[model samples]
Each structure stands twice: as C-alpha cells, then as structure tokens.
Target: MDWGQIFNSTAGWLFSPTTIAYALAATGLAVHFGYAGLLNFGMAGFMAIGAYGYAISILTFGLPWWAAMFVSILGAVVFALILGIPTLRLRADYLAIVTIAAAEIVRLLFTTQVFDEYTNSADGLSGYHQGFRDANPFPEGTYGFGPWTYNQNELWVRVFGVILLAIAVLAVWLLMRSPWGRVLKGIREDEDAVRALGKNVFSFKMQALIIGGIMGALGGVVFALPSAVVPATYTTSLTFFIWTILLLGGAATVFGPALGALIFWVIMAFLDNVLPAMAAVGWLPMTPIQAGTLRFILVGVALMLLVAFRPQGILGNKRELTFVK
Candidate 1:
C-alpha cells in the first residue's frame, strides 16, 4: 500500500469544497432541527434552488458573480417561505413529507428539457465561475506541505470557503445568543408554552426556516465551486448526509455541525483512500469497486454505534433533545 498517497488523499479532504459545503449544510440543519425543532428533511431543495439560481442567472441574465450569489440566497429565502406558509402549521411528519417531495420537484425541474436553455438540464452548467476565478489573488504555485498542498485556484477556493464558513459560524453564534434565539429554543422545547407566553411561534419558525435555507443556499454555491451545478447532486442522499453531520457533531451546539462535517469527511476520505490502496496491493481481499462501497458500509456501522451509544452527539446536550410526543 502507498502510505504517502493514502495520507495525501485523507488530508486533502480537510479543505475540500465538499467539506465546506457539508459543514454549512449541517450548520443550517442545526438551526432547523436543533434550535427550532423543525423536521426539515428537504434541505437539498434549498441547495438545489441556490445552485440552479446562480447557474441560470449567470448563464441567461449575465449577472455579476455577487449579484448572482445574492439572487441565489433570495431565491432560497422565497422557497423557504413557500414551503413554510402552508406546512409549518402541520405536524412534523407533514413538513418532512412536503420538504422531501419539494426537493425532488426542484431536482426534476432542473433536469427538465423545458429549462434546458437556462439550466442546461442534465448536462449541467459551466463557464459561470470565470468571474469568480478572476478574483483570485494567489500566485500560480503550489502552497502548503506534507499531504496538504494546493494550486493557486484551489487555495483561493479553500481560503474563500473558510472565510465564508467562519462568518457563518460567527453569525449563528450571535443569533443563538440573542433574545430571538432564546425564543427559538423555547419554541423548540414547547411551541405551546412559547405561544402562551405571547411569542409569535409561527412567524419565528418561518424566519428560522428562511435563515437556515439561506445558509444551505450558500453551501450550495460553495459546493459548486469545484464542480458544475449538477441536479443529481441535490438528491435525497445529500440531505441525509447533512443530517448525519449534524447528528455526529451534536445537535443544538453552535459548532457541532461544523466539527461533525470535518470529522465525517475526514473519516470517509481515510476509508476511501486507505481501503482502495489496501485492495490494490492485495492487503485487502476485495476489488477496488467493492472497497469503495465498503467504506460507506463502515461509515453506516459507525453511525449506528454512535446513535446507540451517544444519541446526543459529540457536543449535544441531552437536556436539549426533544422528540415529538
């Protein structure tokens, strides 16, 4: 087995665009499920809208990069409002049903031929990041050492992504400390009690939904940096992955989701790289493809163990846990 290659692959995931994207998405889920007690099983829909919104705006309208990003966040907010208006009043399971279905609808809409001109359908979109890339300040040379180096563009992406992630974490931290945040936690604990105390529970829930959806949209934009806006990327599995990150880190904790994302990706990356190398050298008795699949099986088993032993997650407070009665 090539130990150097294995180490490089595993370490590369530390600043990978996928890691940043999942971190942001998990943070958003923490807001919805952790703070607001919302069962939002369709975070992928918000991400899809954000991705398609930015791609289509740049492709068809020729908008500036900043304008396109703003539009994407606005689109996610509007989508959240649409989803929240009729469904927030229903039972949690109903919200889950609507959200998951809505995500699928968004994915199919992007893949439909009628919107091919704007979305490029299943072919996806490119050339939209020229403006984004033009702003890179790093010189064209490799940076970092020992299993963690990147070219100018790659470094630029990671730097910008980390900046965005930091800002998001700080913003969430501040929000969770405010009076509004207190109300959100109260609502999470018991909406009826919050309502009896004269809080606008529905309005608060809608606002939380919008905020969280915007975060997911931002994640979608960053996620598309290293790749094109493929509709297939926003499948139900995407949401499930975000949930896993949230659960892994500790729900209701400000930094749990981000930490969870880092750990989850790191573990997966290690398994992916190491297991394949082992198989290649006959140290493992599996084919390359089987080794790849085996990583996920291992991750699934790990998650089961985590749920069984630490239901509150790495940083979650058991007192904050609330399952619907």
Candidate 2:
C-alpha cells in the first residue's frame, strides 16, 4: 500500500516502450478501421511477424539491427498482401473472422515445433539485444528524472521508440491531408460510390492494409526491443487491446491513437499497483489475486461505457463514427 511505489510505477508507464509500441499499433488500427473502414482483426499477426522476423534474422541470419528491422517490415508487407488479396473483398464481419483466425494461426505457428531452430517454438527467442544495444549513442550512464530514470540501454530504447512514434504520427498526419487520404476516407464512407467514380476500391483497400500492417510491424519491432520475442505476446487479445486504444482516442484523428495509448497504459499501471495494494490492506473485499483480476473487469466495463456513451472517442469527430455510418 505504499503510495510512493505506486506513484513511481504509474509514472514509469508514461514513458515506457510498451506504451509507445501500443500507441504505434493503435495508429495502424486507426488506419484500418478509422480512415479506411477496414475490418482488420489480425493486427496481432502483423506484430508477430515483425517481432519474430526481427529476432530470427538477428539470431539465425546474423543480421544487424537495421537489417533485421527491414526484414521485419518486409515480412509485414508480405503478410498484408497474403491476408488482403482474397479477403479484402469479403464483408466486414467475414473479414474480421478471417483476420482473427489468421492471427491465431500466426501465433500457433510460432509456438509449434516445426521451426524451432529459428523461432525456438514455445520458448521464444532471446539474446538478440546485443546488436540493437551496441548501436546506442547515449554512452554508458543513467539518465532522466524521477520515475523516468533509466540506464543507457533503457534510454536508448525509449528514445528510439519516441522517434519512431513521432515519425509515424507525422507520416499519418501528412498522408491524411493528401488526396490519397481523402480517397481512403471516401472509400470508407461509400465504397460503391468511389467505385462508381472509376476509383479502384480494392486497390485502395489493399494499400491501406499494407501501410497499416507495416506500422503494426514497426510496433512489434519496438515491443521486441525491450524483451524476448514471445509468441504469447501476440494473442487475439492484443489486437483487441489495440482496437480499444484506437477507439478510446478518436480513431480517425492522427494523434488520437497515441493519446489513447498513453492514457490506457497509465490507467492499467495505476490499477496494477493500486488494486493489489488495496486487497492487501483489506480495503477491498477480495484476495490480492482476485483484486488483480478485477482490474481487467473494470477495463472491460470502461470500454463498454466508452463505446455506448461516446463512440467517437475524445478526439474523434462525431460524423466519423463508422458504426453510425
């Protein structure tokens, strides 16, 4: 029940790599469901490919960090093509089914024993940090203030993540202001109308998928930077969490996803600390384990309320609500 410890833990998430990673992924989702109105539910699959692709390239192929990152992005592009080719034409619900299943397949393939040499199957891949860490330019020292303090390696990861997030935000902002972005939104609003205008709806959808998938892949790369590439991390729930973040922030807005990610993780971190402490202090009528589990229930309720009361999210334009359209 130490307030100081809880405060520090909560504050750390504000600048955590995981927060940046989720923010990136949510932005990708915003591209899919927000601007383009795609029903992609396999974002986790793209992230898995990025994380494992980077890890395998580094561990087995002896590639450097930048090369490995390229491989990961290429893998995401390939996955997007594969997933989008036959499925983009499907109805939204069908597309969702296909994507969720595809993501599970990707996760299980990594968990299977077939490619254990490269993926290490269930054990996942580790020891791939040397290349990334070696590229750190901060020199050996602790940095930052208060709960944000970290050693050189941690600082490097956070800095790189922030830079990547900024680049993504800028890229999305610019693209959305261009003609191509307008077409994407047009397709989202009325696919047949765009098609009647002689625009290739299918092509636009595919491009959006690939672009968003690449962003999701970048998110995976950032997520892998601070830890091993564990298959369990890319579950269907991860995609849903990304969706929640996307929806929580204003899906169609450029900065909404990042803002959503920051708020979501801060709340999660606060709950992770305060809930168990409350249980321990008999402030809650549940055991510590039950209290820990209750936080997720609360999150679910919060999401439901958000969806019901304000589906447009904090930064979203009410007219941009896909469900209403």
Candidate 3:
C-alpha cells in the first residue's frame, strides 16, 4: 500500500497508449452515434480487423509500418461497407444486433485454430513493433519528469499515438464543420427531411459508418502498439466501454469523446489503485479481489446515474439528440 507507487500507477494511464486508443475509439463512436445517429455496436470488430490486419501484414508480408497502417485503415473501411450495406437500411435495433453479433464472430474467428498460423489464435501476434520502434527520434534513455518517466520505446509509442490522435481530432473537426458535416447532422436529426431536400440519406449514412469504423480500426492498431494482438481484448465489453466514454464526454462534439476517454481512464486508474490499497489496509472490509470487482460496480452505478440524469452528456447539446421514429 505504497502511496507513491499507487499515484504513479494511476498517473501513468494519463499518457499511456491505451488512453490514446480509447480516445480514438470514443471519437469514432461519437461520429457514429453522436453526429450521424448510427447505432454501430461493433466498434470492437472494426478494431480487431485493424489490429489483426496490421499484425498479419507485419508478420507475414513484412510490410513497412506506414504501409501496414494504411492497410489496417483500409481493412476497416471494407469491414464497415460489408456491415453497413444491408443493415443501414434496417431499423436501428437491427444494426445493433448485427454489429454485436459481427464483433463476436470476428473475435471468435481470430481465436479459432484455422487461422492460428497467421493470427496465433489465443496466443495472438507479437514482435511487430520493430519497424515502428526503429523510427523513433528520441535517444535510448528515459524521458519525462518526476513519476511520469518512460523508456525510449514507450516514449516512441506515446509520441506516435498522440500524433495520430491529433490528426484524427483535426480531421473530425474539419469534416464536422463542412457542408458534408451539416448533411450528416441533418440526417441525424431527420433523415426523411434530408431525403426530401435531395440528400442521399442512405449514402451519407454508409459513408459515416465507413469513416467511423476506419477510425476505430486505427485506434485498434494504436492500442496494440505497446502490446501484442490478443483476440480476447476485442470483446462486447470493449464496445460498451467506448460507448460509456462517448456518453460521458458528450457525443457529437469533436473533442467530447477524447475528453471522456481521458476522464474515464483516469477514474479507472485511480480506482484500480485506491481500492486495492484501501482493502489491503483494512479501510474496506472486502478482500483485494472483491475490491477489484467493486470498482467496476461503482463505475456501472455511476454510468447508470449519468444516463438517467444527463443523457445528453457533459459536452453534448440537448438539441442535437434525436431518435429516429
């Protein structure tokens, strides 16, 4: 129960690759549900495609890092089109059902023995970050100050992740401010009205789906930068977690998802550290394992309360929220 260790561990997540990954994924979710009113519950599936795509390309084809990244984004686009073709015209609930099922299917496929040679099934893929690391500008030494130091490799990953996040945020902001962005908002508000005004509602929806899915896929690749590609990491819970971040930050706003991700991870890190320390010190009556579960329970209750009281979220405009009838 060392206070210094706990603080450092919790603070580490503030700039960690995982935080950047969640920020990117949440941003994509914001585009899907916030601006376009698309119920894409398979964000994790898109991420898996990106992760596996990048990993397979690196391990098998020995593609360059930039090339592998482009392929991963391309993979996301193709997956989005495949998922959106028949489902976008269906009801929102139908899209949700299809997406959730599709994500599970993708995860299981990656875990199966058939593609184990390429995917490594449960063992996943590793040692794919060599090319990425070789391009680092930082010298081989620890960087950062105080409790926030990182080795050259970790710092390189963080820098790459931040650059991608910045580009994504800028891209999203620009897109959401243009005429195309206006059409997307209009579709979210009232698709029939947009259609009557000569807008191709279906086409716009598909484009939005593809764009957001690609973002999620890119996020997946970033998420796996510091770690191996594990199929178990892309589960239904991952999508739900991203949704929570989107809702917490205020969907539809350009920076809301990123802010939400930062906050969510910070809170989780704090709880992960504080709860265990409290239990260990007898400040809580529960064992350490029970404390771990309790933290999630607290987070669940907090989410429920947030939805019940402020469904529009922290940075969301209530006027922008419209459920299609």
lDDT of each: 0.89, 0.93, 0.90
| Candidate ordering by TM-score (highest first) | 2, 3, 1
lDDT of 3 by residue, 42-150 (tens): 9999999989999999999999988999999999988888888888998888889999999999999999999888999999999999999989899999999876799
In candidate 3 the C-alpha lDDT for residue 4 amounts to 92
Q: CA lDDT of 93 in candidate 3?
A: 88
Best by lDDT: 2
What TM-score, computed on C-alpha atoms, does each candidate reach? Answer: 0.96, 0.99, 0.97
Worst 10 residues of 1 by lDDT: 316-325
Which of the two candidates, 2 or 3, achieves a greater TM-score against the reference? 2
Model 3 regions lying over 4 Å from their true place: 323-325
Number of colliding residue pairs in each model = 0, 0, 0
How close to the true structure is residue 233 of candidate 1, measured as C-alpha lDDT? 90
Q: State the TM-score for model 2.
A: 0.99
The digit string of per-residue lDDT tens for model 1 on 1-325 reads 7778788889889889999988988888889999999999999999888888887888899998889999999999999988999999988888899999999998999999998888888988877888888889988899998767788888888888888788888988999999999999999998999999999999999999999999899899889886699888999999988988998999898899999999999999999888877788888898987898898889888888887788689998888878522
Q: What is the lDDT of residue 186 in candidate 1?
A: 97
* Evaluation by lDDT, superior candidate among 1 and 3: 3
RMSD in Å for all candidates: 1.5, 0.7, 1.4
